[model samples]
Target: MKGNVNSPLHSDYLNNKMKSVQRRHSELKHATPHKLRHTRATLAKQAGTSIEAISEALTHSDTITTKTYVNASNVIPMAVGEIAYRNLKK
Candidate 1:
């Protein structure tokens, strides 16, 4: 609430809050919302989230754009055939 009124939080307010928290916390010195988002995307990709899903979550035009946020190299492509084969083994 901006100045005792109900309202959406602005980016400046968020940034200022982030800075204030960072000042009190030594480990969060370089942390920002954008970096946290990128980290979440990368970690989600590493945790087996599909590129399509990630793209949708990020509201990107396509998966190609999402690839930039996700660590592409660490993501192993699991083809449909491979998934089928794994399921058959089980």
Candidate 2:
């Protein structure tokens, strides 16, 4: 199965594979592929990447769609705040 990119897994195959994997790992109950994508986006946001960058990386059709991934703790607002504070002190 490893290093077999030429044999791309189909949707049905992936679903069946996930079923088998989930049975082996009971803790993974209710997990789905979409959840994995959301997790990836959230982690990227937490890592300080801008929403626009994330949007592009995710191939989002609109920026507003990507804004769903934005969080207050993400790096963008913090960086803006820092710059504002520095200017105020100057």
RMSD of each: 7.9, 8.7
- Prediction 2 global C-alpha lDDT: 0.69
User: Which numbered prediction scores highest in lDDT against the true structure?
Assistant: 1
Best by TM-score: 1
lDDT by residue for model 1 (7-44), tens? 54687977898899988987755878777668778877
Candidate 2 on 35-54: residue-level lDDT in tens? 66566677667655677888
Per-candidate total of colliding backbone pairs:
0, 0
Clashing pairs in 1: none
Give the Cα-based TM-score of candidate 1 against the true structure.
Answer: 0.62
Q: What is the lDDT of every predicted structure here? A: 0.76, 0.69
- Model 1 residue runs over 4 Å out of place are 1-9, 73-90
Worst 10 residues of 2 by lDDT: 69-78
